[model samples]
Target: MAVPYVKGIMPVMDQRVYVHALLDQFEARYSGAGGQFRYDGQAWFGSDYNKLWLKSEGTVGTDGRFGDGDHEILYDRSISRYFDVQSGVRLDIDHGPTRAWGAIGLQGLVLYFFDAEATFYFSDRGVAGRLTGSYDIFITNRLILQPQAELNFYSNSDPARGVGRGLSDIDTGLRLRYEWHRKIAPYIGITYSNMFDKSMFFRENNGKNNSGVNFTFGIRSWF
Candidate 1:
């Protein structure tokens, strides 16, 4: 999986600028490889805020195994500094299981234990959705800690061709990253995904949620 990024407003400007690019690969008996590139801009409109962004990423293997790339457009509004409402569309372009979808996210970054997102999609395969939540604590200026999890849910499948995993998956991970001057950072982390037990989708598609660890090393910066 690629590094995920979110942008709102910064303390310095009435409106701020941020851009990031990330790459990650997991190699093992089961390998999943992917990366993400994004550009975001946000500004304040009186009290309500507005943002627009574009991102592209993909994943393969099992955890870092074989997978495809996904791209998306995000537009959102922030009711306040700590709370926000967002809506975005995602599409699979390369090695597609091509689909288009929307989502919403909530974050309390200043506080701990509370970042979440829910997504619903109309895919070429079927209708599906996922819910993910995470908690984070900044241990120091150079170190930030994150614990996260995800659940995938699917509805309707092609039973005859044996297509689609009508199951939900659970993933848990501990991530740590170091930031250098708020512009560039290198990080490494690990995760375990349990894809088999929760839903028919995982069981049927043979999308087993074998636990795997991820290692990521890359540069993150903006101008």
Candidate 2:
């Protein structure tokens, strides 16, 4: 006797991974009398519904030599269509007492256009929070303008890191770029930064200015 023929169906799963490098900033500061570089980027692995995420950002000064800077590393989970809730760590690696922080944050696209992030941090020294927002405007098919702002607040003074209670600092910048390709664009911009409250006093005591402007020239890219 011959058995009846049958076919088995198997479930299919979709999986993918991606990496992007965003907001690369290299600029010369007039007040600090130095050059600075900054970068923010992320990578993720897994399926559409769930994934492991890694995000990082850092800044360094280049006056005569390269030195340590403030850096962050975060792990994130996508909980909604437009947002990710993240938690990780931050390290202040510049010319002061090196301090580590526990970080929790939300990053996402708002209203289908604006990119925004808000993060809170806790350290042995104090509590801190940072909020950032940026929007892109297209003047033509290839030419684009971006305006960005970041504000930082603290719950206590951290003289070791030059931060203060209440609002610590605000930074704003405007950039215009012509996309040479979808992956690369050289841009020019200006940034204005100001420190407030006890943060200003700390700067003054350290022989640094409380506010300044920077001229930025850099390339923004991703892959």
Candidate 3:
């Protein structure tokens, strides 16, 4: 009998260009404040090792008031199998006065499953930071439950924006989604968010609601 030889698989993980976009939250939120629309999404371009990332999120009330219109542009470099380092700038642009910050961050997966990101910001005003994480639990092949949370903090207060120092605020939600296709999911969820400590006090002084609970329905899609 003759013997046959076999070749092993070759690595091809980071050789070509790619583009991706995710509309993670595009929804309507109903609350005591009334009806509002919100969007949070990101798009990126490039190869596995290097890329450009654009992220933006905002909310609009029925009266056409826009809030939290945060946008960021970053250069991202893959540093490990589960992590990337990002640096760039962030802009807070809305109907109100605009603010800008220089940003640096780490974005990656955790424990082989959860998605997480930690970013720090600096401006003439002061230093700031954000941490966000999300995870999905499969109820079935096509049905899933996802929980997400985000926290924001600052080193100094910005009275112009009504931001307070210390642990500023938190947002969290629990959503159940059903995938009509691998690329699209529609979900319904309840979101609870509040400002904390001095931040809450500042909001009260400014005559603003410091917290809210909302019922949300939305579609999430990716390409």
Candidate 4:
């Protein structure tokens, strides 16, 4: 006997669209010098194999000025069970003159289910890149601990933006939270940030330590 197959009930996707957004970091950071706010998040919409992604992350500096860290619009294609290829454009709209770049990157899970991303950028200012990774360790069904880190580099320095050549800065932190619900969790953590070389000043004479340990409290959510 042959079992009947229902096309509509099959697992294969046809022409449906899906949307998801995550506010992975929306918190305030306090250090000895001052307090500031930061956010990092991304959203996507598409079918299982193709999608469009939007991302934006930045911080409000101690001087109460805004720093536009990364703003991107990308086209994403699923390549494997846990990876995607992305090509897009990025904009830096800090207090200085705005700059744009051509961007490409790879994002996925690797080596024991770590979330990782590597992206490269090209523009008249030469080239730049970023690498980031985060991992979650489960302590219970609902309690989880996450450690995250990010590195940024540039080939040419842009004085207007206080960006230096070579390796520029590093941000790393750890947070622990309980899943109040499947889509919402509040967490508290600590993050250390350091800036290097000529970029520290944002201009030359205004540079401070450019390094500090900050306390962070934020919420992580998706829907």
Residue 100 Cα positional deviation in candidate 4, in Å, after optimal superposition = 0.3
**What is the alpha-carbon lDDT of model 1 when measured against the actual structure?**
0.51
lDDT of 1 by residue, 122-153 (tens): 65556777666777578996887767677766
- Predicted structure 2, TM vs. truth: 0.82
Q: Candidate 1: where is the Cα deviation over 4 Å?
A: 1-48, 62-68, 102-113, 123-126, 158-167, 197-223
User: Residue 43's C-alpha lDDT in candidate 4?
Assistant: 98
Better of 2 and 3 by TM-score: 3
* RMSD to truth, every model: 9.5, 5.3, 4.2, 3.0
Point out where model 3 deviates above 4 Å.
1-13, 204-210
TM-score versus the correct structure, for each prediction: 0.59, 0.82, 0.90, 0.91
> Tens digits of per-residue lDDT for model 3 on 144-165?
9999999999999876565789
Clashes of 4: 0
Candidate 3, poorest ten consecutive residues by summed lDDT:
2-11
Top-lDDT structure, candidate number: 3
What are the Cα lDDT values of the candidates?
A: 0.51, 0.74, 0.89, 0.88
Summed backbone clashes in each candidate are: 18, 0, 0, 0
Instruction: Give the alpha carbon lDDT tens digit for every residue of 1-223 in model 2.
Output: 6545556844444445555455445444444565566555556655665555555555555433233255777777788989888888888776667788899999889995799999999977788899999998999988999999989999999776678899998888998888989878888888887889899888779654426788877777766
Residue 40, candidate 1: Cα error in Å is: 14
